[model samples]
Target: MERSTPISRRPKAVALTFDDGPDQIWTPRILDVLADYRIHATFMCVGKAVQRNPQMLRRIKDEGHIIGNHTWDHPNLTQLPLSDVQTQVLRTTEEIDRVAGVKTRLFRPPYGDLNDDIVRKVTSLDHEILLWDIDSWDWKGLTGPQVAKNILGHVRDGSIVLQHCAGPTETVKGTLEALPYIIEVLSESGFTFSTIPQLLHLSAYR
Candidate 1:
């Protein structure tokens, strides 16, 4: 299946987003890397994680990074009932608003799982569905160099690069290690990193 590129007016811009996180150890590390590069990215945080790490979410927002809902438990929305899908998305939305004091304007279904009904349900809740064009695949136990290669090899203008900060130790390790290299290489190539809302020209918070 062909994936659609995210909408962007600037040809040299790319939106970097992380999923399933706000993890105690990895999230902060990723934040540190972003801080070092002085770049901003989006984080699609799971509700349970947000509840567990409200301070991390606060830091993400405080640092000018956008946060999106990745659902409460990271379920495949396409297979779930519509009501269950609503619960998953809305619960996360509420949790984010509760912690960050801002309603999320973006949603990325777990595993990129979505269908017409799921889309409708999410939109009904006023979220723009977000997906990525470039996947780092850092969760596949790839080394940091390999993950960096995967991202840089596929990245293009207006790409949304998907990565994760939560998972097994190796997954987090590869992602963290590859981040600085990704930022440096892409910046040298004249690409500016952006948050999803910034790239899409949508509201980051409601």
Candidate 2:
């Protein structure tokens, strides 16, 4: 879905977003798990990765998942000049649009570090900035139980979950191991997943 109705007009929901994909190995595996549940998640893709693997980008879109820009290179936007920040976001959006035949309306800053300048630039592009309500810490060397515990501990209505598809070797290992349990717990708890844009409607846009 491109956008969700206003939150007051919509049912309670959460979003699970993965950043820095579509990775050859990790992204596909992640997609499989989400598909098994018939759930949709959003992928914030790096532009160069999308360029290198257009087919994977198509697959993400074809499977009913939304794509968002995470930049051409996953850089700390707070450290870059305004021009660089604009380039990072815009380039990724163009790459995603080219492969998916859709222009994504959401963007997540790499590292979740958004300064006012970067926010203004991203907003100027007409993309909403996505911040997480739940930080699973899958990027940390936490075991499956730990990751599951971390998420379930904080999950609530309209939560946005942060997970990683790209990271240090250790971080990626933790994410892969923890994912199944995380999905199962949230699914059992009567929560449904959607993309960032889908989670943020008029009533919940704050």
CA displacement after TM-score superposition, residue 175 of candidate 1 (Å): 0.8
lDDT of 2 by residue, 80-130 (tens): 999999888888877787788887777778778877778788989887777
The per-model lDDT (C-alpha) reads: 0.88, 0.76
RMSD of each: 1.3, 4.8
| Number of clashes recorded per candidate | 0, 0
Please give, for residues 106-197, the per-residue lDDT of candidate 1 as tens digits.
88888787778788889999989888888888878899999999999988778898999788898889988899988999999999988887
Which regions in candidate 1 have their CA more than 4 angstroms from the true location? Answer: 1-6
TM-score for each predicted model, relative to the true structure: 0.96, 0.88
State model 1's lDDT.
Answer: 0.88
Q: Give the number of the best model, judged by TM-score.
A: 1
